[model samples]
Target: MTVAALAEVADVSAVEDRHVRLAGVTRVFGRPGTPKSVHALGPIDLDLRRGEFFSVVGPSGCGKSTLLDVLAGLSKPTEGTAEFEGRPIDGVPAGVGVVFQEDASFPWLTVADNVAFGLRRAGVDAAEIARRVDYAVGFMGLKAFAGAYPAQLSGGMRQRVCIARTLVMQPRLILLDEPFGALDQQTRLLMGDELLRLWRETSATVLLITHALDEAAMLSDRVGVMSARPGVFIDVVETGWEVERDSRIVSHHRFGDITGRLWEKLRTESLKHLRDG
Candidate 1:
């Protein structure tokens, strides 16, 4: 076959793997071109493949959350399009779950209750809700605390509860926005191990937004770094790590090199954010 044919075949294969696509997307907080309008994101093209972990890293106020919102169908782009599984995203696309940075757990609900909330709301059978909640609680290591309320748990545990809540939905695509941002560095690393395990077991596509370059390097298959507000991807660094790898791989000889690449791109954008702010 000719080289052009080979390239076309490769491109076709890539197209088949995509689970989400953002084309020429741009988001503005207010009216377009108005003095008060904040052009937050886009003209950015992004693609996420089935069962891959993709992380977005950018300086503060660079609209990292805005990008995720577009994917979640919570916010419409001022220009361009956002699609999931080959269709335009329309109001929280089916089989998609999101875990935000804030502690979203309800203090009034027990761990088991919180995990089962979504299932119940969807009118799932009581038995099915119990079964799925059981698995999610165990998977998140919250089985022992199943009866405890959010206020009684540690910050990390509460985050795990939030994750479990999302997990019980059996979502095919998981959007995580700094889910462990409130935890200590050590706790964050340990939580990354849990996330890795969850991804391995579920085979769900993951898109994480994080400020910690090391955390992005530790968890993602590829990391995209964005510029300051009016954010656009400045670089995307592929980790080439195996899907089964965990946070322990942070000590691997190549880990530093991978993080170095992310920092190199992120550093300039971060400085720009500070200056603009």
Candidate 2:
């Protein structure tokens, strides 16, 4: 499908119970009066529904990371607004969790302590922090290794530890920026299944930024494709995958079709970025 057509569908489908809303949001960097200034991301309009799994796929350097940062309140938009649960996001909004491409685990801390770190910082009662930590550790299948440090775990297990830390915070929105990019393909797929299981168990609205087309198709209910730098959301493709989706979804016939459609839009923008550079 064409970008325009996909955007039209998105507009028509957007409803009232939005968990996150970005309206005409844009981000720019460099000195305002300088010729070197760069416009990094949108004047984009997008809505994420409560508990929805939304993935974003785009070419490298298409400002996908910038978009994720804006959503996480790590960076501010130069124009327009980013709202979370009906309030404007000013700075590090509460109940929002972010997982990056790098391993965020603190090697000095045990898995259970790491998961409880955020809660402890917030001055949550000791008993409540322990309870949440225990629940999150079990949820991520790290109960067996709760006392282990990050260095003792495999790459996938470390990522799970990172996720468990975020989960203990009970975030209403979770932002993942290429969280599996460092793993091997097999491990990446396994982590995807694990993520799906976690998503199903929580009420968090997830926004994942990934370059892997198949990963996006397998995990997302709707995938947004972005244009080259000064990035704008060009299209939103529906994967039509059920909420109970898993790695088995790669075997579904429609998976290829959705990924292909996303690539069609992404390829053009990617080439455009290369040429402009």
lDDT of 2 by residue, 1-277 (tens): 9999999888766644688999999888986557998988888899899999999998888889998888888899988999998899999999899999999999999999999999999999999998999999998899999999999999899999999999999898999999999999999998999889888888689999998999999999999999988788889998887787799889889988998899999999989978987
Give Cα distance to truth, residue 33, candidate 2, Å.
5.3
lDDT of 1 by residue, 74-185 (tens): 9989999898988999898989999999999989899999999999989999999999999999999999999999999999999999999999999999999999899999
Query: Alpha-carbon error at 101 in model 2, in Å?
Result: 0.9
> What would you estimate as the lDDT of candidate 2?
0.91
TM-score (C-alpha) between model 2 and the true structure:
0.92
Every candidate's lDDT: 0.93, 0.91
Q: What value of lDDT does candidate 1 attain over all alpha carbons?
A: 0.93
CA RMSD, predictions in order: 2.1, 5.8
Candidate 1 deviant stretches above 4 angstroms: 1-13
Candidate 2 local Cα displacement, residue 268, angstroms: 1.4
The parts of candidate 2 lying over 4 Å away from their true place are 1-16
